[model samples]
Target: MPRKSNTDVLALFDTLVYTCQYRLVLEPASHVSARVLEWRQGLRERIGLFHESYHMPSIILCSTELPPEYERSLVDAIARGSEGFASFNMNIGGVQHSEDKRTIYLEVGEKGIIAALRQRVVDHVRTNRRIKKLGVEVVDHARLVIASGLKADQFNAAWAMLAVQSVMVQQKVSDVVLIKRELGDTSMDEHVRTFALTQGV
Candidate 1:
């Protein structure tokens, strides 16, 4: 699905600020990539499972004042993975605001690979057991969706109205991971908590 539909815009979402999440990006041009796009765009509306429980963890489980940027290693690893996979650069769709979720999301160019990546992330997080209890899943693939809440609704609305046109340089995906973001007075830093694929290899 196109990741920016409002939980407020033609979406049925309850009002609440959720916390915590697990996320990963996919290589757009991968082998089964075609299936993902066909499913998300064409078949999703017909599949009740797609909309009912397929919401991204970042969208429904976590709240962030800041949007997530690719980790330095993640960026490099993805570039390296491009040799074996079909990679597409990350694009910022826009700031999307619903009733309360002022989320900034990255648009998936190769929606298929992104979907596969999501499932892989779910499998990886499950090994943690503890985090598994947190109830994060990988079925619904999306790059990222950090909430801004009502405080930044105006900014989100302004951006959401704008169309997505910018093209980004594609990157590879050597690894997928779950990271913990700790907030500071003026900034936040990520600490790698678990790996969905390879960490050192």
Candidate 2:
């Protein structure tokens, strides 16, 4: 069953959990209905998997945000080392959307060293960021999701228009940023924190 966003839950030790359909809490006096109750006998049952939520920050993800200081350094380094490379701009072309159980992302184009640069930024964030490490994974596409409850086929028109234009620019990643949201909305959020690419990718 999907994790509950609200309603019945169980809490053994400050952990809010749900067993069956009932909700639970920690305090000894808290009452629970047998309609849904924690399975005291199944200690061997699998616990669960949890992941840190990530949202694309408004910095490089948005056009108006200030360029990170490290971006200049990364750009200069790439220009010097990568052949056939000149200058590039930070461009976001891929589109992605996720609702309910599904998500969609847009594809980013332009291969070569730009991919490497993107990796560096990802590595830096995964290593240095203070709060929680957003797992590092190379997203090959700048994906856009049309949304759930609607047919994926509905995106045919959008895909056609986007399909014609290459979105990932050969330029700099600009910066890495940390974005925050309330509880959900895992899609993309306005950037609340930022790291510049002017100094490094």
Candidate 3:
């Protein structure tokens, strides 16, 4: 059964900026990167099968809600601050469901590279006076969303159990992409402007 399209502008906005999220875009290692590609494809297929598909966004490392203007400044600061950090590798562990069961995602386990990278970003954000005023906090456990919104009993319990079992696997992280949500419709190359973490690593 195809899920019905329910495009609520308010809802979409809520989801987009529900919290100000700091994310690192996940990209395949190279043209010949088979392992990571396979894992990503499998997640997409499983989400589609359940009629719970949604565009998978980048991995969010930390999130918070902020005043509109403050959010903009914080993003700019992050861009500047990120320029000092080098790109690092991350590891994907397995699949898990959000506590509310609203989202399915891949678990990101922290390695030394990722840990140091995250700390650097967190420290910069927290210490910045403008950002500090917003009271935004950083969180551990970065994850890539696979799908969101599932109705209980839409299928047997075993369906979700099987789905989780089938696609749980690990892979290497190759790239980090930073993105920001645009406020209104404008002529822009990307709906979310992505910045590659290329300075340090």
Candidate 4:
């Protein structure tokens, strides 16, 4: 066996650093997504400007950064975590803001379904000590973001405009998506993998 120089060992350590971000999300159907987009456009026009670009409507469960080597194990963890969960129907409606009021989104009606799945995934993935230390914030509240990076006036206007109207759209959530992007990628472009839930008899 040959011995490696210090430089080789340093290079190997650098490669192991986290280089990609992973997001677990529940995406709305195409038709539902269209409606949400329309709603966002309405808000944009009313508010006179929107701070951020558009993204497809989805309820994010959790997100974290990890090294590329862990990707396969993460997929396997998600698969095992999602086992036995049945599909459920949910309504996307109502308007809410984050505590800072910098972001606005549509509220997801059926919260328990997402909460249960998040718990399962956290359990499976966090079993690894390496991942456990990293932040895996699976918040209790789930939402489909409309517009973010809002100014004080923009937030008030958008919120008031949405709060008055009844905006309920229903859709069936059958699967969760695992999305990944490189460390420096800011655009929404990424690889998406779906894990379908078990069908109920």
Q: Best-fitting candidate, measured by TM-score?
A: 4
- lDDT tens digits by residue: candidate 1, 7-68: 46523322232333223333333322433333323323332222212332222212112123
Please give the CA lDDT of all the candidate structures. 0.36, 0.31, 0.50, 0.78
What ranges in model 1 sit over 4 Å off? 1-101, 137-141, 144-147, 150-153, 156-165, 183-187, 193-201
Give each model's clash number: 4, 37, 4, 0
Higher-scoring candidate on lDDT, 1 or 4:
4
Native-referenced Cα lDDT, model 2:
0.31
Per-residue lDDT over 1-201 for candidate 2, one digit per residue giving the tens place of the 0 to 100 score: 888544334223224321111000001111211101221111112222111123221112211111244333333332332322233453444444444323333333444434555444444333433211212334433322222232344344333433343333233544443433334434334334333444443
- What is residue 195's positional error in candidate 3, in angstroms? 3.4
In terms of TM-score, how similar is model 2 to the real structure? 0.34
Between prediction 1 and prediction 2, the one with superior TM-score is: 1
Order candidates by TM-score, high to low. Answer: 4, 3, 1, 2
lDDT for model 3? 0.50
Order the candidate numbers by lDDT, best to worst: 4, 3, 1, 2
Question: Which residue pairs collide, candidate 3?
Answer: 25-177, 86-200, 86-201, 87-201
- Work out how many backbone clashes candidate 3 has: 4
Residue 61 shift from truth in candidate 1, angstroms: 12
* Model 1 residue 177 distance off true place after TM-score fit, in angstroms: 4.1
The runs of at least 3 residues in candidate 2 whose Cα sits more than 4 Å from the true structure, single-residue gaps closed, are: 1-87, 90-107, 124-137, 143-150, 156-173, 185-188, 199-201
Clashing pairs in 4: none
lDDT of 4 by residue, 5-115 (tens): 998996787567656778888997787678777877798678865633445567888887787787787888888999889989888887777999988887898888789
C-alpha lDDT of residue 192 in model 4: 62
